[model samples]
Target: MRRDNVSADTELEYNLRFFTQFIINPARTGAILPSSDKLCEFMTDLAGLGDVSTVIELGSGTGVITEKIMRKKAGSTTFFALEINPAFVDATKRKCPDAVVYQSSAENVMKHLEMHGESGCDRVISSLPWSTFNGETQQLILDSIYDVLKPGGVFLTYAYVLGVVAPASWRFKKKLYAKFDKVETSKIVWSNIPPAFIYICEKASR
Candidate 1:
């Protein structure tokens, strides 16, 4: 079940995990397949990884983004990947051994970070589906993210091109606007399946 090395990703299993998981829980998994290389590139490029001492990744499904982050900025910072799915945590850990993969919810990020003796991170890169959660759950996730982030920290997440039109997606956008000082939306990443856009959010700089 484990790969020989962290870099080795079996093409078949990688595709199945995302597809099957999305079918079972479209809201949580979000994507029909793993995020595309181009999308990952755009997100990480704006992450400001060089300045942060600590960064955590949320909802790391099959470690596509996680792997890309590790590959690009592994030596610059410490990454702790928090995923709710045990299977995903396993795959992410295998793919990104340098990262600390925790099977935990984003709502409990503070507790998990403390349990691991980690500090509030400077950036949070999430792949969680905000449009699926009810208002309360959405607020809870945002609250948790805001609390765990350093005052001037940044938080980033992506949404499908189609989801932007949904009421839930707009509501989520409003939540982001309300909670953060600055929220920057990226141009569409056409290479991704279903196409998508990245939202680069940041708290006010201290």
Candidate 2:
């Protein structure tokens, strides 16, 4: 029961922080509430993150998914949680001190990894707000992702059900199809505030 209480407290804290951040900058934070544990579970299961050696988490707000990933580690692995929000970065760092919490744009992921003597990631889980970025910005970020992900690596992110027909979301999906040979989607996670689904894109062999 102690563990359950702690989880509830963490969830509450995450929700408060996420709402404040979204109020400060909606485009940066995306949702008003932190991703629901239900969504995190679905994402972790679809990514099979426990099996990967190096994982990169883009836009890891409040470490919701980061917590899920760390809790299910099946092997030794490195994790980097990147976020542009200083508050979210600090909060996530406090919650997940083991991860390299980077307060930088995901576009800089390659440079940051190189600085740490790392080359590529086996899997990347993004919580970024793709529906807010322009096509050029989206391309730049996706290119960076491709550069850092090892061949056969997977890139996963979620889109709110309402975002499915948004112009930016539509374009982002098209970009994923162009870059990845295999793009798969998961069933909607109705438990989340706005309802969301996961996209699992596999990098093709060169």
Candidate 3:
């Protein structure tokens, strides 16, 4: 759905179409459909990133938001992007050359961290379509993210309107509540065609 009169770049426009056709439709990639620039900026602000040393983005399609993050990068922040789509991954690497791009799934982020001897990430920004995943896979991904997060690190995810994207049987809300110390949903971005909400979660203290 077209959201704004502001046109996306050629790369971003192509990525949006690719995500809609291959990821959101097939449900294989588990990536959310492309979000409007306004929505992406809103999510970034809600992440409350300050002095973030390492930032990881899951499902970095076409690097639309990845590019924005790189442009806004703080002095010490290093951005890492993990994507399951090979074409999109290659495009992201080329588009956001400053980011460390990984052609892999978010479920494997823990192993990636371990292999790289990385302890924890400061923030995680995700565009994975959690509604397409089963309960177990969703929990697994969330657990993996938690395992590699610094104390009080935040995770940001987007979902279509609450009732529509998140169903009761999906148990996403319940799992999130159980997994994180705090979870909050943002106001709907009505400016977007289909509208969406941002889910921000913070890891609890042990």
Candidate 4:
């Protein structure tokens, strides 16, 4: 098969896998399809991965965003991913063979960081479904993210346009503003499925 045809077929396979996971566990597998390439590219670009020494990806579903991170990060970058679902973990590993994918929850990011002999990471790009998380779950994960980031670190995550109005999403937004020193939202990427926008946040440089 042609390279483009092969790529299209692989993406279709990933989409089916994502949708199946969502069907199996809607609460954990929040998105029905893998993130669009445009959304992933926009997020990684805004993250400024060129100089970062350490990076972590949270909730790397099927490795769509993870692939972008692998390609964009500097050669010296130390990167790993946290994913709770075993199937998704396997998928991520398959997609990014060199990726260190731990079958762990986002709340345990600190432990993983310690294993790599790092105090904190410079950038955190999350694909977690904040809109599907309950208040407590959201706060717990956010707290983990906040604590694992070094001062002046950047955090990036995106939300679907429709999900932005959800009560859970609103609460997530508020938490980002409250936790970070600066919070910025990007223009919607209409090419993405359901359309989405990114939230760029930075920890204070003390």
lDDT of 4 at 64: 84
**RMSD versus native structure for model 2:** 1.9
Candidate 2 lDDT over residue span 1-206, tens digit each: 12342476776777788899999999878888888878988898888876788888899888888877877655578777789999999888777777778899999999887876789888889989998999999999999998899989999999999878988899999999998879999999998989999999998877
* Residue 147's lDDT in candidate 1: 88
- What tens-digit string does per-residue lDDT give for candidate 1 at 1-206? 33334333575677787788878877777778888768887898889676668888899998878877786664857677889878778877766777788898889888877876776888899989888888899999999999888888899999998888998888999999999999988899887888998888888867
Per-residue error for 167 in candidate 3, Å, reads 3.3
**CA error at residue 67 for candidate 3, angstroms:** 1.4
* lDDT for residue 187 in candidate 3, whole number 0-100: 91
Candidate scoring better on TM-score of 3 and 4: 4
Candidate 1 matches the true fold with a TM-score of 0.90
Clash count of each predicted structure: 0, 0, 0, 0
Task: Report the C-alpha displacement of residue 190, candidate 3, in angstroms.
Answer: 1.6
True lDDT of residue 38, candidate 2:
89
Report the error of model 4 at residue 79, Å. 0.4
Local error of candidate 3 at residue 162 (angstroms): 6.1
**Per-residue lDDT for 105-203 in model 3, tens only?**
898887776665678887899988777788888889889888778888899887767446356324877787788889898999987545888878898
lDDT of each: 0.82, 0.86, 0.75, 0.90
Task: Give the per-residue Cα lDDT of candidate 1 at 13.
Answer: 76
Model 2 TM: 0.93
Winning model by lDDT: 4
> At residue 130, what lDDT does model 1 achieve?
86
Candidate 3: lDDT over CA atoms? 0.75
